[model samples]
Target chain A: MDDLDLDHESVYDGLLGGDSSQWAFGTDFEDPLAGVDTMIPAGVDGAALAAYCLMLGDDALIYAHRLSEWTSNAPDLEDDIALANIALDLLGQARLLLARAAAADASVVPQMPEGSPVPPEDALAFFRDEHAFRNMGYVEALNGDFAVTIVRLLLFSSHRLALLQRLATSVDPVLSAIAAKGVKEVTYHRDYAGRWFVTLAGGTEESRRRLVAGLRTVWPTYAELSRSTQVETLASEQRFGVDPAVLTEEVDAVVDHVLAMAALERPDLPPSGTGPMGRIGRHTEEMGHLLAEMQVVARAHPLGKW
Target chain B: MTTLAAGRTRAREIAGTVVDPEMPMLTLVDLGVLRDVTESEVGVSVTITPTYSGCPAMATMRDDLVHALSDAGYAEVEVKVSLSPAWSSDWITAEGRRKLRAHGLSAPGPSPTGPVQLSLAPVRRAIDCPRCGSADVRLTSEFGPTACKALYQCNDCLEPFEHVKEI
Candidate 1:
């Protein structure tokens, strides 16, 4: 890992890899596939659609909740708002993605014998039973040293941002729209973590050491994100989703750069097997505790509107 | 004036005074979140956009909007939140941005695009030192005292300042 110095120049230096190119910020453009009116295509697999969405949405929601925990506990008062803003962005993405998943699933599931309105809350609530959340294992791991947290964030956000960038062109309008806005948020998030990675990796020997240990702790769980599930096939059929396998190279390149920049070595640990089932709801013990805290009040007062 | 028109005129007067919970100096109307005011048979309905999704203070703002309308003699009122087009710093009025600057904070710049070089643009491009009119400033951190602002230090005035992070 390359040691980054905060003393010689501003931290923003080289954040974009010294690229002189300007990056557009918002996802407010007109849709490329706009005007083609078409019915749902043949053999359209709705279950796969719901599963993929659950994977994306659950990741956003759980991670947003985790990030929110850092509020007021950040190293500086400013970071409180920064982290909170990032969390809010993630929450917004989760709401839209989850809503999209629910809407897509609703289309396929056999409705009640008679027509009945299925409220949004119920749609969101009924999807999971603990063995199917395919979020990157990085976010759910117990909060580790700050250096480690930044590394994990850097890894996750870059991957997510890249994923969203590809999804923005999806045949599904809803998915495309959500991905469009999401790309910007994820970009900011990735940069924030990357700048910090450079700072810590280059700051001091102690910061450097902690970053390495943090990388090892978080790296094992990342394999789960790279695996291709059946959902990817359904998404590809729909024409907007990227093959998760294709993204491995991009993810690896960035991760290697950051790890190298941080003056840390990627651990050569053999992969401990874990994949798609986690996103389907088989979360580790940490998730149960997190959900207990997150869902407690809402569950206790079911149907209670604030 | 007609009775319906008269009621609307008064309701607008009351809503005009509600301040933003985040940026205290600016009114909600100044931030452009408060949208339409519709008078139904039951009561008056006020629509607004949230600055960020899941903002806890929105409930408080809604309550405040209702109370203020009631205090002004409009008994029935409804507050609606919309997320379409989302929220933009561009929605913030010029006067609100001025007030933010007066309060020692820089207004947000436009959101960046595709790939950005922060060094090329310079840290204080969108910011002007409210205390001193100098343009030479450097951002020390993206996180500021508030979520909206980034921490900046002025080169000329030698003062640490906050620049609003453009969403």
Candidate 2:
């Protein structure tokens, strides 16, 4: 029999060529933005641009961490694999954005010890305190039931899809390239969550009730996602960033259509304060727990090799 | 031909023939991922792009290129990854499309020229079954067993196959 004739049990087995030792989730890393001209655009504030990228990067990093929590806990096998793939995509985006932020301004990267081998992205992800993260509350909030996860994914993906589309045209080449690739990935993410959202909402009595309850649980934090911060405002004015506020109309239109199709109502909920606290290193109580779990391994073994 | 030019051409041919470990149906050249190969005073430099950002096949591809070039008697081989002007599904060569279908995976349809429309459902493209060449097929899942393909079942043939996803 030929070497390729070996019966493979899964796609990964085939993809890895029957040897899993060389394959790793994040270990075999290559610079995603390599060979791209990362020069900051003329007339843009380097510090503000880096800060803006931190916000975007932190959002993806935290949400990816939350999604990874579903690895062995997803409702089914397919959902398990799907959520893992989605998390990896977000992780890839976070890496690129964080790397870009460091390139734009090294000051934003957390201080690493001399001769430490940790990359800038890893440093930011593992070294930062809870109060240093800029992710919106929606991502850092504790995951509830399956319905709540679906609701959160739907809302986050929709908003992110709109924002990435606009950022695809940024004057900065690195940001534009990242957004160009992100647009496709986020489109799939939004569609995946939307499909699940409709399925549960239209499935049965229990599912419908859970879906409604999930919507109510997450609705209060929705306003925080679109609130623009001073750094974002400055970057947007300079065309280096897309203001989150500008994405509201597009986000609402997509969400409204989906809700109407699913026969679900837009939960009437009060906004959770109109502050840019999240962007300025203030986060929910859950953020501390999330960071503690995420940073434990790295903190215990600084410069550890996987 | 000069010795340098001949070495460069030979290196390109060796690198271009390295098969993608994941797909196995297409080589680097067929997929348009091998962007360019150049000869410098130091050695041969090969450039490639990834089909997806998180694609695990890139590391294998790079290693394969370096090994193949070294086996061809080229020294100081360098492989570089490029992301600007990111890869598109449209870059898959016509020959690559035929090979994918022969391997029981439907080739990706032409990518939409306009911007992607944000909708509730995934934008479904009409894909013929690779097994029966039947147009009667339905997407079973947006994601297939791998990141680059989607699962589809052919109603006419009653067989399930993978379709290379349009990015």
Q: By TM-score, who's the top model here?
A: 2
In candidate 1, which residue ranges exceed 4 Å CA deviation? A1-49, A103-129, A132-134, A240-242, A263-267, A303-306, B1-19, B27-50, B57-86, B115-126, B134-140, B144-146, B153-161
| Overall lDDT per candidate, in order of appearance | 0.66, 0.83
Top candidate (DockQ)? 2
**What shift in Å separates residue A90 of candidate 2 from its native position after superposition?**
0.9
**How is the predicted docking of candidate 2 categorized under the CAPRI scheme?**
acceptable
lDDT of 2 at A145: 87
lDDT of 2 by residue, A194-284 (tens): 9899889888999999999999999888888899988888988999899999899889988898899889778878987678787888888
Kindly give the stretch of ten consecutive residues in candidate 1 chain B with the minimal lDDT sum.
Answer: B115-124
What fraction of the correct interface contacts does each predicted structure contain? 0.16, 0.35
- Per-residue lDDT, model 2, residue B58, is 77
Error of 2 at A56 (Å): 0.6
Estimate the overall C-alpha local distance difference test score of candidate 1.
0.66
Candidate 2 per-residue lDDT over residues B1-167, each given as its tens digit: 49888877877888878988888889998888999999887778899987776677777787778777877777788888777677888899999999999999998887656866655654567778889888988877777666677788899998999888888
Q: What C-alpha root-mean-square deviation, in Å, does candidate 2 show against the real structure?
A: 6.3
